[model samples]
Target: MSRKLPIVLGILFCLITNHSISQVIKEVEGLYYNTTGDLYTGTYTEFYESGNKRIEMNLVEGKRNGKITLYFENEKIQEVRSYSDGLMDGTWITWNDNSVKIAEATYKRNKKHGKWYIWDDNGVKRYEMEYSEGEKVGTWYIWDENGNLLKERKF
Candidate 1:
């Protein structure tokens, strides 16, 4: 039937397209890398044994050069960070297994050079510290979950 021919052709087309798209995914024993290595440079995507995405990052000249994202076994995002010339240069955030944010910090050239804040599992501020050139050079504050200031120390 003429109508049946069209339907079969459409289905064939879809199958072929999907197959080609899947083939584009670079495959490894336990990871995937980008095709056209020149364009992607040294970027890679690592996977868990169950085939879940574990980490994705960009690299240039064999060093981390851009944004990186890591995922937990449950496929929840565990952390996100940005790098410049292989050094952490911007905001970095880490999450617990429950997908709750545990800590956030800023860095410059791999050194903790700015504010860092950490929270407990209950979403309570645990401590806040300031850093200068990788040294704790400013005020550090600790607080209870109930917002009670426990202590403050200055360097």
Candidate 2:
């Protein structure tokens, strides 16, 4: 046998015996789960009935605990969210069907806690707002597609 035979056999064994580690464990109502680790921490993905990816998110202790991505039926990304210990705690972004960014915001424990921006499908800035713990604060600006300020307000 070649010197590399043992290594190759070991890899083959792992591939055959551990395939379940990456296999989807469950599917219910169009959702699929793939988990590993002692705590079963891994990614869980859901598919739309149209066969497009609906959502893909990480799970820690079976709770949403990491980056989450959502997709439209056309396979375009619709939104991206981050979670820590099952609560939203980081950047969140959304895009329109045309792939133009529609909104971007930051969250701390599922609450809007930072600057938020909105744009139209034509990629024109529409609004900008500030928030603290989900409450609107500071100044906000609204503009038209023609780059004209439609309104401005201070909270």
Candidate 3:
């Protein structure tokens, strides 16, 4: 047998075994439970129709507690978010289908609490704002499509 054949076979075996180990869970009262009626705590994955992973999130005691990643149908990363006790608690970022960053923000306990930015589809920054505990609290800037500052407003 060729040396490459062993590597290929090993990868195929891993994929098959990995797929078989995934368990389906149910949500009840906003918490996830496994088939055994126990709190589900593991990597939860959702797949696109094409068998690609659309979302992957980590759960601890049925609560989201880590980084969650979402992918476009083409398998590119579309968004990434951080959570703590099922609440948004860190940096969140999103990208357009073309792989350009479109938006980014920081959150604390599900409330906007830091800098936020938004970009147009063509990758030009369109907005820059700040928040404190979900309330706007600083000067906000808006930019035109050509990347020129259009307006600045103070809160």
Best model per lDDT: 3
Clashes of each: 0, 0, 0
- What C-alpha lDDT does candidate 1 achieve relative to the native structure? 0.80
Candidate 3, residue 138: lDDT: 94
Q: Write the per-residue lDDT of candidate 1 for residues 64-94, one digit (tens) a residue.
A: 7788999998899999998887688889999
TM agreement with the true structure for every prediction: 0.72, 0.73, 0.84
- lDDT, residue 60, candidate 1: 66
Candidate scoring better on lDDT of 2 and 3: 3
Tens-digit lDDT string for candidate 2 (24-127)? 55543333344532344677666665546788888776567878999999889999999988788999999999999989999999899999999888888899
Worst 10 residues of 3 by lDDT: 17-26
Q: Of the candidates numbered 1 and 2, which has the greater lDDT value?
A: 2
lDDT of 3 by residue, 69-154 (tens): 99999999999999999899999999999999999999999999999999999999999999999999999999999999999999
- Please give the distance, in angstroms, between residue 4's alpha carbon in candidate 1 and its true position after superposition: 21
CA lDDT of each candidate? 0.80, 0.81, 0.90
As a TM-score, model 1 comes out at 0.72
Q: How big is the positional error of residue 118 in model 2, measured in Å on the Cα after superposition?
A: 0.7
Candidate with better lDDT, 1 vs 3: 3
lDDT score for residue 95 of model 1:
92
